[model samples]
Target: MRRMLLTFCLLSLLPVTYAVACLWDSETLEQERNKFPGTLEVITGNFPRHSPAFYQWRLDDRLNKLANDPDNDRWLDDVAVSYEKLGRHSEAIEVAESQLQRNPDRYETLANLATFLIHDGQWEAGLRYIDRALEVNPDAHFGRERYQRLLVQYLLQNFPDGQVEYPLAAGDRIDFPTFLVNDQPPGEDGQPPKLSIEQRQAAVQGVVGMMRFSQHDHPVLLEVLGQLLTETYRPKVDAKQLAARCYLLLADSAASPATQAAYEQLAKKSLNLQATHKSGSEGQMGLRAVRRELSGELAAAKKRYNSIVLKEKRWIASGVDVEAAYRQYVNSVQW
Candidate 1:
């Protein structure tokens, strides 16, 4: 639930069939917007909806339980999560901090604290907590913490203020793979690559975990997942199809028409989807079908995600060591 609550998405000027290769300047964004027909509205209402009242009820219930059993400490996370869902990030952080102060070894509390901090735009602080959480249980969440660490580092390095200046693109072509070893063997010279096979494989696992557990709408996550799929060969996964879905979602969440257009162009150019369609309108029709398919897939994934959370709770009740159990589970299924 924490994973689902915190993840988010973003955009270019495209609709469904394009991809973006580089970041655009403000002037470029405006110029592209002018070239498009009608304005592309920022998409909303598609995600699984939860009412504010539902969160308020959950918060009240958790608070009541905490009042009854002040020493239990279990209710703290529930309260914090409810607060976060209600848009009270400061309160969430406060609750999580108190929980951490009480039991610093608790992995969920550590991760929740990091998430709340990130939600509040405290990227550096969030990174620190994420590091602590990783130390507590690096294998938790299917090793997804590593990717989060890397992502925060990238964001802090490129945009210290935690806001993207323009629509992100891969430039004339998608190129992050150049830095990674991917599926290939080590260089003949026997030198290590910047992103070795192990690292790339682990990062792909993290991205897959995020896609399965978190909301599918977050643009940064989508973009990174798309990039990883294109670069790293994941057995049995349709890289081009999945990457197209990621860009399609990007277009949906784009801030302006120009950004949406850029993503659409990227999808078509990068995925070679245009070669099949006779016209842009035909390509759009195909994209709509793909979008519907992706949405259905997301819904099923959400159900599986909820089941995992429940399974974790049950394991805790049965006195199971969750981190060790999760590590075993990751080992069993990991690529």
Candidate 2:
């Protein structure tokens, strides 16, 4: 009890609106959990379950207090967040919705409510909360992360082995990464990344495919498609010119010189990303495989080039620079 009190007081920085005010603490100095206000246990990532009793005691005490004046207190949202942390989905949603109705514009409440909704697989409502968070702050990482995941889920359910585009407030689609290997990749800071790896891959694939499916080409598609292909040919690969494939395709299909340049740049980034996979787990067998595969002659790449040509040109009826993609295509081809 003494240790937990000290820990709680220690973490409480200057109050910043709801973030700190939301936590519970002892009423008297040096006391803990006997007379606290809020129901949140606050088991943050760094603080593990070292004191389960302390948290439970606090929660129980707070629950009793709330039962007395449940209609007036705004602790429901905090309780919901705590329930979510404990994987108590049903209770979390109940509290989250209750809080949301009380104060519809309270973004924090809506965001917390949405989390439980997603956990409960109530996606349509979850997306509404996500949009609420975005409206509060388009860069809200937590909201965007949840929102992005829901979008993928919606797509998967609607289109098995198909894809859709999410209209993000920042933009319609992300600026695809060029092929390079950076240990800690940077993405939109406050935008939460989707959790499912397969879902993310599928979403990327859908966007890339849509760009190609368009007869009238989209210049932005090359960058987006390049990122998908880069991830597709993932780690521990040997000569997966999936990087070059993206480049070669973009190079052929690009409508103008400027667009072709963008393709070249995006493709180069892909190769660099692939390079990060080389020369780890150094064993004789692994080394042999790497040597055999990396050193092997790359078969002449025609399918990739042809796809790009057809893709970039079909859309550029309005005088696109066909030569730009053509020159880049010829340069990349190895007989």
Candidate 3:
């Protein structure tokens, strides 16, 4: 009786939740607003209902239209991709999966479903699809390499903590050296080495610095130099060139996370500015007190910050990318 009641409750909640999910909102409506700029009220419950379900419901209609009409396969890929982009991962997965069912060898749909599943954190499910995808035709898509990398990353993330005393798991077949040899081949077990506590601390600091240079008007060279110095020597990034490349790559806006973070920073920064103020600080600290303060203390504080900054100048010599030049300024500590 209790199990039956629980099942009934869950069944009842389904439609209730689904109904709420259907309600259009300021966020959703606003995102769509730009799909057709200048046509603010151009869509909604009125015109053909650009409902979230439209893709599932009207896919047939669109495909029928495309069949009689000449259009690129991109038309279908676009619809699936767009839905996935909108956070409708399940919907995207459904559409892509349905298409794959009809065409078992469709790498695009299978790979895309695998992506949506992984991004949604359905790791086991995602891998299952990926395995099926491989069986579909192993070499069908060269891009599967990226999926394998992601698979390695995911496995590493899920590696059992403290399960065994060995530093590296059996699946972590490759040591740092092994991976380096095979272009950082993922351990057969799919796990990345668990960073040490010290390494974790450095990574946190490095990522924060990355955030600052990424968002603020700070010099990229200096930020990268400082971060790499701390990470490798202080924290210890043994792969100097690889780390440098990662930082430079992020700074260049050539990579996705870097590009997204950069633009978001730009947008947020564009919205902020120092406030202008109207006059008020003249208690004229009895000229004696003012003189005492400035002459005795203010100069010291100024010199400290100045000294810290001055120490950074030596790195300018080898160029931020070079080690010998920066090693002295940053000091050689294990990152």
Candidate 4:
């Protein structure tokens, strides 16, 4: 009876032990060995030299012979990258994994494999390989940078704020012109009409949402939002209110006292505009509440903001239809 009980206990502990082993061990490379079938159809169709298909053919020809040569390992990396660039992600992953089977300590191969996996939307699994690569060579700069980039990409995508399709990278700065459509007249030679204010707002909102969720501070994103508010002409939208909201968002990520103060000044200008405007009562009240919140009157501001939110179900909210109110207020002040 004692022997049987001991055997059963040992059997039960096997899975737990294995899980623990897998957790601490950098043997994912070993476990992934032979996981993917070693078969890929390389298309050799002729195309322009600059085309991906031409690059694929060239790489495929080299890979066929290089796969057998253990000394020429770097060529294998090139082939894998080319396969990825050509949208042959599965083949890229297979090539990378095969290379790892022969040379498991190749940090570059490991990093490349991680990137391929991430590109294929297998980020969690890919991150394990990144950690393994960094483990093998902590000083691998490319590997480390790739790992951080992947991490940021994952965070931006999975963040609760909003879904973003843009591929973000470190030191990546987007200019305002990139968001603007060409100046061609609408319907001339089939040219599309200019993007509406709502469309621009949506685009800017997507960017701000990503920045809001990003773990890393993004002053560039805040600056871009600020610039958009100041530069864009949306006749209906109250730019001041938008500026105030942007300033509040920027405050969270501001790195210096000067930056914070600048945001505060901008917020104050927006608040003053809202308070002085002869707009709808609800809009004025909402703006006052936001100002109060910014000015450290949190309890009253929260109550007012909450009341506005509760009333949103029945009426156009504070910020909506703000353009008409803005024009009315401006005309009133001017007259």
For 103-192, candidate 4 gives per-residue lDDT tens digits of 898888987888788667676667788788878887555223332443334443444243332211113433342334444466666745
Output the lDDT of residue 85, model 3: 50
**Candidate 3 global lDDT:** 0.40
**Most accurate candidate by TM-score:** 1
Q: What TM-score number comes out for model 4? A: 0.33
Q: Indicate whether candidate 3 or candidate 4 has the larger lDDT.
A: 4
What TM-score against the true fold does each predicted structure earn? 0.62, 0.34, 0.32, 0.33
Instruction: Report the candidate with higher TM-score, 3 versus 4.
Output: 4
Displacement of the residue 235 alpha carbon in candidate 1, Å: 9.1
lDDT against true structure, model 4? 0.49
Q: Order of all candidates by TM-score, from best down to worst? A: 1, 2, 4, 3
Point out where model 2 deviates above 4 Å. Answer: 1-58, 68-74, 142-335
RMSD (Å) per prediction: 15.2, 27.2, 27.2, 30.1
Clashes of each: 30, 12, 15, 1
What order do you get sorting by lDDT, best first?
Answer: 1, 4, 2, 3
Q: What is the lDDT of residue 292 in candidate 1?
A: 67
Runs in model 3 deviating more than 4 A are: 1-74, 140-143, 146-153, 156-335
- What TM-score would you give candidate 1 relative to the actual structure? 0.62
Over 1-335, each residue of candidate 2 has an lDDT whose tens digit, in order, gives 99998877766753432222111112211121121111011100111121222223334545776898785435565466556655578887888677767777777676677657855657666777777876776655422444254343544444334433321111333433321111234556843332235543444444433332221123334333434444432332111233344354555566677666655555454444222233344211222232233233222123443455464444244344443644565467542
Residue 248, candidate 3: Cα error in Å is 10
